[model samples]
Target: MRVAVYYPWVYLRSGIERALIEIKRRSRHEIRIYTNHFDPRGTFPELDGMGVTELSRVSVERTYSAVTAAALSIVRTRLDPAEHDAVLVCCDGLGPLLTFANRRKPVVNLCFTPLRATYDEVYRDRLLARGGPARPVKRAAETVFRLVDRMAWRNFDEVICIADTVRRRVADNRLFPESKIHLAYPGVEPRLAVPEGASEPMFLLPGRIMWTKNIELAIDGFRRFLRDAPPALQRFRLHIAGMVDAKSRPYFAQLQELAGGDERIVFETVVSDERMRALYTQAWAVLAPAFNEDFGLTPVEAMAHGRPVLACNRGGLRETVLDGVTGLLVEPEPAAFAAGLRRIAQDADLARQLGAQGPARAAAFTWPRFVQTIDAVLDGAQRRSV
Candidate 1:
């Protein structure tokens, strides 16, 4: 099958890029891609190593204008005249344009969640929870995205959600027949080895430093966990890794000041994949306490390295981490996180058992499985089109 995956933008450093690479690797289908972001500066290093045929390379003008222009271009040039077997809208933002452009082809939405619900579940409260005077602007942006999201959902022939929890939201939107929608979770690239015999207790946090990531909560929990631990056991280190979003610079500064030259905490921003693998390998556990994490990549990647994760009990994290098995799941509160940390810290055997189970679990979600599912979906859709 020849499929076109259409997306509004591209960020080379993200999980989406990894998923694309994996799909490209595993699929027998001919895969072509379309994107609105074209950086002549060679910004997307990941794209350098891939074999993707680009349909158009125009830059987006502004928020509303970009969507309009992208939509127009898709309708005009991207899809060959009845050429694609299927069109996979990579995210909610591209759905409107793809649906309008390729009415002759089946359009499948590969989404993490319903965009409208995502705004309500995570972003809305997150802004108000942390935004202070910027709350009104945040709320208005949510409203705009909500309307755009709903329109996009209604237009797609099928929508693929990453978590079971998101299935309810897709159903509520009445987007497609129940059978047409699929719950296709993301998978991690397999790691060949796990680091052994760590002398010191080390914990890792990976992802952007945005308010939604709730790194502040993770930091607070770390502080509280030490307070409740014995002095000898409180010498553990927390490695916070990932690029800091510009919007989060102030918050990051504040967090650094709070750490105040404490030897127990280290902050690393924008590290390479090799460095990330090292962090996961050496760490005692990975922590992600964010709410509605929407198919968290870090936890699964950590699990792939045979490292136990201590994560929030809700959202996509719930689906990724098998509670009491792969890792301990706790509520998002600081005390709960503190307790989870302490539990894993005290039990080396239990941690080892969980860590050992991780690779097997992650193996089931290989890139081949992901692409096979999509190929089957697209094949069926093409048959229907004929």
Candidate 2:
């Protein structure tokens, strides 16, 4: 089969690249990616090591322009009546897919979420209240998305959601055949062996310190957890590793102020992947309290390290974190999160058991499995066209 995968955003770019690489290596299919956005400055070439072929490189000085160009190209090419075995669009925001609704090729859309609901439920207010043209722009953008989403869903041959929660939401929308919708989780690299002496009570939370991450809640929980923790456990530390952009400066300042007079909370921004991996290895668990993550990669990385993850029970977190088995999932409330933290702190054996289960569970989500899952869908699409 010949597969063309379109990725409009840089973030989703890596995941598509990984799956393509796996398909190229293991599946008897020719896979190529088409993109007008080249982040030569970014680490996108990192996927080259994994073996995905880049069919075309489109350069753009700005993010939005690149996305628009990509979408337009999809409609022009895919709708030209020139058929392909399969066409995979990485996310719902790609508008060009709607234009190609009646194309002869099989269209597989990776539906991460309904864009309008994503803004209304997760990001709009918090971002809007922050005061910027960004908020209103998002509002207008979401309105446009509602129309795009409906067309993309009805037009595509199949819609793939990353989690069951997202699938259920789309199912309720009832725009397409239920049989055409599929659940396809993100793939992660295989787990590494747990490092010796990894049972120490350190916590790793990596991701940008943005409002969506709910970093405020994590900080509050950690501070309160320390307040009543036993003397020995007081030494336990949290190392937050990630970038702190100018937009997040105010929130970052508040986090720093909250940790005042407490030396256990360490904030390191723009850390390297190796440094981030080291933090994951040394920690007893990874803390990801994000409120509206579509699908988080941090907790998966933690699982890859054979470390347990403590995340809020919402969005993709619930799908990723196996409560009582892989890691503890708590509500968004600080007290609830703090209690879970304390529970693991006091029960070393239980923490260890959960920690040990993580790597094995992480094993089932390798790049190979992700590629295979996608290949099966593409093959089925090809057969039906016959």
Best by lDDT: 1
lDDT of 1 by residue, 1-386 (tens): 78887665564355666676666677778877666663422334666566455666555443446655665665465477466678887764444555655667787887755554234355545646766876776667656756655665676766677667666656755545566678777776555334344524998998777666778778888888888998766868899998765456888898798777778889998687788878888888999888767678888887888889999988778888999889989999999999998888888898888888888777756666787887777777777778
User: Each prediction's TM-score against the native?
Assistant: 0.86, 0.81
Clashes of each: 0, 1
lDDT of 2 by residue, 201-251 (tens): 787788777667888788889888998998988978888888765456888
Off by over 4 Å in 2: 11-27, 48-84, 95-104, 116-120, 124-141, 191-197, 243-262, 271-273
Full-model lDDT for every candidate: 0.72, 0.68
Clashing pairs in 1: none
